[model samples]
Target: MDLENQLKNLFPDHVSEKVSEKKDSEEKGIWLQDDPIICKYEKRKGKPITILEGYTGATEDFKKLAKELKQKLSVGGSFKDDKIIIQGDYRDKIMQILKDKGFAVKRVGG
Candidate 1:
Protein backbone atom coordinates (compact mmCIF):
# COMPACT_ATOMS: atom_id res chain seq x y z
CA MET A 1 0.00 0.00 0.00
CA ASP A 2 1.03 3.60 -0.55
CA LEU A 3 2.26 5.70 2.38
CA GLU A 4 -0.78 7.97 2.18
CA ASN A 5 -3.15 4.95 2.19
CA GLN A 6 -1.42 3.44 5.21
CA LEU A 7 -1.48 6.76 7.05
CA LYS A 8 -5.21 7.14 6.35
CA ASN A 9 -5.87 3.63 7.67
CA LEU A 10 -3.88 4.21 10.85
CA PHE A 11 -5.23 7.73 11.58
CA PRO A 12 -8.80 7.92 10.35
CA ASP A 13 -9.69 10.79 12.72
CA HIS A 14 -6.73 12.91 11.65
CA VAL A 15 -7.14 15.61 9.00
CA SER A 16 -4.33 16.25 6.61
CA GLU A 17 -3.67 19.69 5.22
CA LYS A 18 -2.87 20.00 1.57
CA VAL A 19 0.57 21.28 0.86
CA SER A 20 0.90 24.30 -1.48
CA GLU A 21 3.73 24.46 -3.97
CA LYS A 22 3.94 28.22 -4.11
CA LYS A 23 7.32 29.94 -4.07
CA ASP A 24 8.07 32.62 -1.51
CA SER A 25 7.72 36.23 -2.66
CA GLU A 26 10.97 37.17 -1.03
CA GLU A 27 12.85 35.07 -3.57
CA LYS A 28 10.45 35.17 -6.49
CA GLY A 29 9.22 38.77 -6.45
CA ILE A 30 10.85 42.06 -5.57
CA TRP A 31 9.69 45.65 -5.38
CA LEU A 32 10.62 47.51 -8.56
CA GLN A 33 11.84 51.05 -8.09
CA ASP A 34 11.39 53.96 -10.51
CA ASP A 35 14.87 55.40 -10.37
CA PRO A 36 17.57 53.70 -12.37
CA ILE A 37 19.96 51.47 -10.47
CA ILE A 38 23.59 52.33 -11.01
CA CYS A 39 25.82 49.75 -12.71
CA LYS A 40 29.48 50.57 -12.71
CA TYR A 41 32.76 48.83 -13.43
CA GLU A 42 35.92 49.12 -11.40
CA LYS A 43 39.23 47.38 -10.95
CA ARG A 44 39.96 46.04 -7.47
CA LYS A 45 43.01 44.02 -6.52
CA GLY A 46 43.94 43.86 -10.22
CA LYS A 47 40.59 42.23 -11.01
CA PRO A 48 37.42 43.61 -12.55
CA ILE A 49 34.23 43.85 -10.58
CA THR A 50 30.75 45.05 -11.43
CA ILE A 51 28.96 47.15 -8.85
CA LEU A 52 25.26 47.94 -8.63
CA GLU A 53 23.85 50.50 -6.26
CA GLY A 54 21.23 53.22 -5.81
CA TYR A 55 18.32 50.93 -5.19
CA THR A 56 15.58 52.69 -3.24
CA GLY A 57 13.64 49.53 -2.46
CA ALA A 58 13.78 47.51 0.71
CA THR A 59 16.97 45.76 1.68
CA GLU A 60 15.34 42.37 1.28
CA ASP A 61 14.38 43.17 -2.29
CA PHE A 62 17.89 44.28 -3.12
CA LYS A 63 19.35 41.19 -1.55
CA LYS A 64 16.97 39.01 -3.50
CA LEU A 65 17.93 40.77 -6.71
CA ALA A 66 21.59 40.31 -5.87
CA LYS A 67 21.09 36.60 -5.36
CA GLU A 68 19.24 36.28 -8.65
CA LEU A 69 21.91 38.15 -10.55
CA LYS A 70 24.69 36.04 -9.12
CA GLN A 71 22.83 32.88 -9.96
CA LYS A 72 21.97 33.97 -13.48
CA LEU A 73 25.52 35.04 -14.23
CA SER A 74 26.97 31.94 -12.55
CA VAL A 75 29.50 34.10 -10.77
CA GLY A 76 30.48 34.95 -7.22
CA GLY A 77 29.29 38.17 -5.60
CA SER A 78 28.36 39.77 -2.34
CA PHE A 79 25.82 42.25 -1.01
CA LYS A 80 27.77 44.72 1.10
CA ASP A 81 27.47 48.34 2.09
CA ASP A 82 24.07 48.54 0.41
CA LYS A 83 25.62 47.55 -2.91
CA ILE A 84 25.91 44.47 -5.04
CA ILE A 85 29.50 43.63 -5.95
CA ILE A 86 29.65 40.94 -8.61
CA GLN A 87 32.95 39.53 -9.70
CA GLY A 88 33.98 40.51 -13.25
CA ASP A 89 32.70 43.39 -15.37
CA TYR A 90 29.39 42.00 -16.50
CA ARG A 91 27.69 45.34 -16.97
CA ASP A 92 25.90 44.40 -20.19
CA LYS A 93 24.62 41.11 -18.85
CA ILE A 94 23.59 42.62 -15.55
CA MET A 95 21.78 45.52 -17.18
CA GLN A 96 19.90 43.17 -19.48
CA ILE A 97 18.85 41.06 -16.54
CA LEU A 98 17.61 44.00 -14.50
CA LYS A 99 15.76 45.40 -17.50
CA ASP A 100 14.11 42.05 -18.14
CA LYS A 101 12.92 42.09 -14.56
CA GLY A 102 11.31 45.50 -15.16
CA PHE A 103 14.05 47.52 -13.47
CA ALA A 104 15.68 50.64 -14.84
CA VAL A 105 19.48 50.52 -14.85
CA LYS A 106 21.95 53.31 -15.42
CA ARG A 107 25.35 52.49 -16.82
CA VAL A 108 28.14 54.39 -15.15
CA GLY A 109 31.92 54.64 -15.49
CA GLY A 110 31.90 53.31 -19.04
Candidate 2:
Protein backbone atom coordinates (compact mmCIF):
# COMPACT_ATOMS: atom_id res chain seq x y z
CA MET A 1 0.00 0.00 0.00
CA ASP A 2 1.00 3.61 -0.50
CA LEU A 3 2.20 5.79 2.38
CA GLU A 4 -1.08 7.71 2.62
CA ASN A 5 -3.06 4.49 2.71
CA GLN A 6 -0.76 3.09 5.33
CA LEU A 7 -1.19 6.15 7.51
CA LYS A 8 -4.93 6.05 7.13
CA ASN A 9 -4.94 2.43 8.14
CA LEU A 10 -2.59 3.05 11.02
CA PHE A 11 -4.61 5.95 12.42
CA PRO A 12 -8.21 5.36 11.60
CA ASP A 13 -9.71 8.11 13.72
CA HIS A 14 -11.27 11.54 13.34
CA VAL A 15 -8.22 13.43 14.54
CA SER A 16 -5.95 11.49 12.26
CA GLU A 17 -8.30 11.99 9.37
CA LYS A 18 -8.41 15.71 9.95
CA VAL A 19 -4.64 15.88 10.20
CA SER A 20 -4.29 13.89 7.02
CA GLU A 21 -6.53 16.28 5.15
CA LYS A 22 -4.64 19.25 6.51
CA LYS A 23 -1.36 17.75 5.47
CA ASP A 24 -2.69 17.20 2.01
CA SER A 25 -3.83 20.77 1.83
CA GLU A 26 -0.58 22.21 3.08
CA GLU A 27 2.01 20.65 0.85
CA LYS A 28 5.01 22.85 1.59
CA GLY A 29 5.16 23.35 5.31
CA ILE A 30 5.91 21.80 8.70
CA TRP A 31 3.54 20.46 11.29
CA LEU A 32 4.29 21.74 14.76
CA GLN A 33 2.82 21.94 18.22
CA ASP A 34 3.96 23.32 21.57
CA ASP A 35 4.18 20.01 23.42
CA PRO A 36 3.03 17.55 20.84
CA ILE A 37 5.06 17.62 17.62
CA ILE A 38 6.72 20.22 15.39
CA CYS A 39 8.58 19.89 12.06
CA LYS A 40 10.36 22.69 10.24
CA TYR A 41 13.41 23.56 8.20
CA GLU A 42 16.03 26.21 8.68
CA LYS A 43 19.14 27.55 7.01
CA ARG A 44 22.30 27.58 9.08
CA LYS A 45 25.61 29.00 7.88
CA GLY A 46 24.55 28.73 4.22
CA LYS A 47 23.36 25.17 4.76
CA PRO A 48 19.76 24.01 4.73
CA ILE A 49 18.66 22.02 7.75
CA THR A 50 15.47 20.27 8.69
CA ILE A 51 14.34 20.35 12.30
CA LEU A 52 11.64 18.15 13.75
CA GLU A 53 10.68 19.69 17.06
CA GLY A 54 8.39 19.19 20.01
CA TYR A 55 8.20 15.50 19.38
CA THR A 56 7.27 13.58 22.48
CA GLY A 57 7.73 10.52 20.37
CA ALA A 58 9.14 7.39 21.98
CA THR A 59 12.88 6.91 21.92
CA GLU A 60 12.75 3.87 19.73
CA ASP A 61 10.38 5.47 17.30
CA PHE A 62 12.38 8.70 17.15
CA LYS A 63 15.56 6.77 16.55
CA LYS A 64 13.91 4.75 13.83
CA LEU A 65 12.62 7.85 12.10
CA ALA A 66 15.96 9.57 12.29
CA LYS A 67 17.69 6.54 10.85
CA GLU A 68 15.25 6.33 8.01
CA LEU A 69 15.58 10.01 7.11
CA LYS A 70 19.36 9.94 7.24
CA GLN A 71 19.45 6.91 5.03
CA LYS A 72 17.01 8.38 2.57
CA LEU A 73 18.81 11.72 2.38
CA SER A 74 22.31 10.26 2.62
CA VAL A 75 23.24 12.89 5.18
CA GLY A 76 24.17 13.19 8.85
CA GLY A 77 21.39 13.96 11.35
CA SER A 78 20.39 13.60 14.98
CA PHE A 79 17.48 13.63 17.43
CA LYS A 80 17.72 16.29 20.13
CA ASP A 81 15.29 18.07 22.42
CA ASP A 82 12.71 15.62 21.24
CA LYS A 83 13.39 16.82 17.72
CA ILE A 84 15.10 15.63 14.56
CA ILE A 85 17.69 17.76 12.82
CA ILE A 86 18.89 16.72 9.39
CA GLN A 87 21.74 18.36 7.57
CA GLY A 88 21.46 20.14 4.21
CA ASP A 89 18.51 21.85 2.52
CA TYR A 90 15.88 19.25 3.20
CA ARG A 91 12.72 21.32 3.14
CA ASP A 92 11.27 19.28 0.30
CA LYS A 93 12.48 15.98 1.65
CA ILE A 94 11.35 16.66 5.21
CA MET A 95 7.99 17.90 4.04
CA GLN A 96 7.37 14.74 2.12
CA ILE A 97 8.59 12.59 4.98
CA LEU A 98 6.27 14.23 7.50
CA LYS A 99 3.38 14.05 5.08
CA ASP A 100 3.97 10.36 4.72
CA LYS A 101 4.17 10.08 8.48
CA GLY A 102 0.78 11.84 8.75
CA PHE A 103 1.98 15.19 10.08
CA ALA A 104 0.72 18.51 8.76
CA VAL A 105 3.78 20.40 7.54
CA LYS A 106 4.20 24.06 6.61
CA ARG A 107 7.28 25.60 5.02
CA VAL A 108 8.38 28.99 6.28
CA GLY A 109 10.99 31.13 4.48
CA GLY A 110 12.68 30.92 1.15
Best candidate according to TM-score: 1
Tell me the tens digit of each residue's lDDT in model 1 across 1-110: 99988999999998889876544544456878889999999999999999999998889889988988899899999999999999998999999988987889999997
Off by over 4 Å in 1: 1-28
Q: Estimate each model's TM-score.
A: 0.76, 0.56
Q: For model 1, give the 10-residue run with minimal summed lDDT.
A: 20-29
Alpha carbon lDDT of each predicted model? 0.90, 0.69
Error (Å) of candidate 2 at residue 53 is 0.8
Best by lDDT: 1
Q: What is the Cα-based lDDT of residue 105 in candidate 1?
A: 93
lDDT tens per residue, model 2, 28-108: 333333353455668889887878765554566667667778998899988787778899878787778767766666565
